[model samples]
Target: MIWILSIMMIIGIIIFLDTWRGIQTVLPLSAVEPLANDEKVSVIIAARNEEKSVEMTMLSLLNQTHSELELIVVNDRSTDATGLIINKLARRHERMVPIHIETLPSGWLGKNHALYKGYQVASGSFLLFADADIHFEKDTISKALTYMKAQTVDHVTIAPDLQAKGFWLQAFISYFLYGFSVFKRPWTANHDHSRKGGMGIGAFNLIKRDVYEQIGTHEGIKNRPDDDLKLGQVIKQNGYKQRFLSGVNQLWVEWYPSLKEAIKGLEKNTFAGFNYSLAVTVFAITTILISHFLPIFTLFSTDYAVQLLSAIFLIIFLALYGVTIVKMSSYSLWKLVVYPITTTIFLYSTIRAVALTYIKGGIEWRGTFYSLKELRGKQHQ
Candidate 1:
């Protein structure tokens, strides 16, 4: 009992410190001034069945205050009307370059291959890799470029404002963000000396064109489903300058529309995040279960000291939740009351990800199957 409490206390303190550093260090995009520069920027978006939101995303980029920007939208063999929409938009706007890929290349994920193709045709001093569904404010690009030049960073990744519609979906997202911020320590990426911390968002990964090519580009992380994160890892490992920002109002994306979709969406990355190691996955589940779930049961213990300690640990946990929701999201702090339930849902999603991947022998992403053997082979590459 004492050992359990001790470990819980340690985890609680670590989370507190990590959450504090993240909230304190991650600056909002609005805080930066919009830069007026003549440097050409290429915005690359890989679309696979993104017909619904791709037009909106393209229009937002077209309306950016940054005049020296080109839009390269890749239609990654979408079975839907995504390609038609891209072609229509491209016809209407000369700055929009549309690429249609009929088939994914051998040994490459669809999106990654699409992005590499976009890069090949990109004639810009800077490249911004963004998702097809992301919407940007008029000044978002200009402000991002300003911050990059101001910080002298070669890579910049901004965390967008996640637009989850329902209560449970919002709660899950809130918990997911909290866990990611606490464990990943994204703020550490801003520290020039820290090789252990870095970040990249699929919605917004802005990097100098030379640096992107220098790191081997998407070809380096071709098979990774978590390509955005691995991109950041490779950048930091190579000792490049990187920065992270809070794009809360400046950029927005509907990560997943519902709880069911969110769970299904995470299936691609959650197991890969643990390197597909069942042992690592199990250890993470056990640790989270003990640190988060056990406290509730401990609160009913006969020993008053044990109950008090459990209560304190839970308080720290809730405080972390509150801070994460209030700072990283626009959700009300009152949502922290459901942290326990959301934590359970997160655990279920992680477990389901591992189970489904193993049961199917691989993951099916964007209508493609990547075998576990190939995925593990490309784990650290």
Candidate 2:
């Protein structure tokens, strides 16, 4: 019992300190000065069955305050009206270029291959890779360029504001952000001297054309489901300067419409995040059980000493979670009331991802099935 209490305290202290560091280190996109310059930035977006949000996303890019901008929107073999929408927008707007992919090549994911195709024809000095569904403020590109130029960093990835419609979804998103901040330590990515800390957000990843090509571009990480994160890792591994930013009001993405969709959405990357290692997955599950669930269960212990320690651990846990909710998300602190419920759902999601991947021998993403053997073969940072 004494040893368990000590471990809980240690975990609490580490999470608290790390969460504080992340809050302090991540810069707000709104605070940066918006630069209106002549440097052309080619914005690349890969869309598959995103007809609902692609137009709004494209319109947001077209209306950027920065005058010199190009949009390369790729239609990755969508069975729906995504291709038609892109073509219609391209016809009306000369700045927007549309590319249609009829088939995905071997040894590559659909979205990744589509992005690589977009990059091949991009003529800008700076390249910005974004999701098809992400909406941006008018000055988002200008402000991002300002920060990149001011800092002289080779790559910049901004964590966008995750928009959720319901209370439960908000709770789950808040908890996800908290876990990501605490475990990933994203603020460390800003540390110029460390290669261990690197991050990439799919919503907004801006890189110099030369830097992107120098890192072998998407050709190197074609099979990686988490291409955004791997892009940042390769940048860091190759000794390029990288920075992470907060895009609270500047960039927004409704990650999933409901809890069911959210769970389905995470199926592709959750197992891949652990590098498809069963040992690592089991270890992560064990750690989560002890750190998150143990405290709640121990609160009902008959021993007074155990109860006190558990209560202290819960306080620290809530404090870390509250800081993330307040700083990184638009949700109120009241959402912390659902911490236990959300944490359970998160654990379940992780387990489900692992189970389904092994059972199916692969992951189904964007209506395409990628084998685990191929994914593991290309799992190099």
Candidate 3:
């Protein structure tokens, strides 16, 4: 039992190290560079039912510091005012083009299909695949463009400010991202050029147009619920210099409306992230339970011989989360401090995701039901 505890503590420390070693930006977005007119940037936004965020997001794009850019928004059969808002933005901003997605064709997820449609119309040297919910600082596009040019990478994705904050919202909004970053950063920063180990946050991704074609866009990852992960994998497999822009200062996106919405939002992604694999789901659940929360139950040692080990794990979790929180913004240190509860909520969300993906095989998002079985069936082909 003591040996098991010691090994667990060691593994936790390794996670801590990987996180620290891989991240080039603590906050994920304070870096800035200016875009030049030598190359034009085309920003494509895909909206399904983003009535709440569309207005602000459009306004932010219109206010971009760089004038050598065009914005195209694809309204993907939204049942709400999402299409109307895009039309309004097109009228308001000469640079904004409103593209209508007639319908979701078979075998394509909503966002990817919209992006592909948008991509067909964009004529810029670089392509920015941004979510409808993402609102940015006026200078965001130019800065990101300049940053990418300097990095000499084919694709650069910024870790944006994830805005949502009931205790649970604050806790897990970026947990998936944090895990993704830790897993891939070490190899990415080293320019390893390997066929594995690279990832990105999809809210704001900048890609060279040529690379986008090389990877095959939504068609390449049509069956995957987690398109962002597929994008990263494709980038690495093709030996491209995939990157992270840690300048999260002016990058902000609210993922959910309420606490319940927040929890459900993560549950959907987590379920799909595991590829509906039962073994991986069980391992993830057990690891989170025993490795992260056992200190509270004091199960490692009644005599508490492993007190040092417990403290180490907690501190690492705290430090990484604390740094990530600081990058998100200093709005509430108190919210970050309650991360233990937040982590428990996250664990719950993960469990729910697993159940929905495996048992129920149904994923509900913005009033649509996506079945894991159907998705897997497509993948096997």
How do all models score by TM-score? 0.98, 0.98, 0.90
Q: Candidates' lDDT values, in order? A: 0.90, 0.91, 0.71
Tens digits of per-residue lDDT, candidate 3, 59-164, equal: 8888888787889999888989999988987897789989887667777778778888888989998998888888788888887777777767787877676677
Instruction: Put down candidate 1 lDDT per residue, 72-178, tens digits, no spaces.
Output: 99999999999999999899999999999998777898999999999999999999999999999999999999999988999999999999898999989999998
lDDT value, candidate 3, whole model: 0.71
Give model 3 RMSD, 1 decimal.
2.7
Alpha-carbon shift of residue 301 in model 1 (angstroms)? 1.8
So what's the TM-score on candidate 1?
0.98
What's the best-to-worst order under lDDT? Answer: 2, 1, 3
CA error at residue 125 for candidate 2, angstroms: 1.0
Top-scoring candidate (lDDT): 2
lDDT of 2 at 150: 91
Comparing 1 and 3 on TM-score, the stronger one:
1
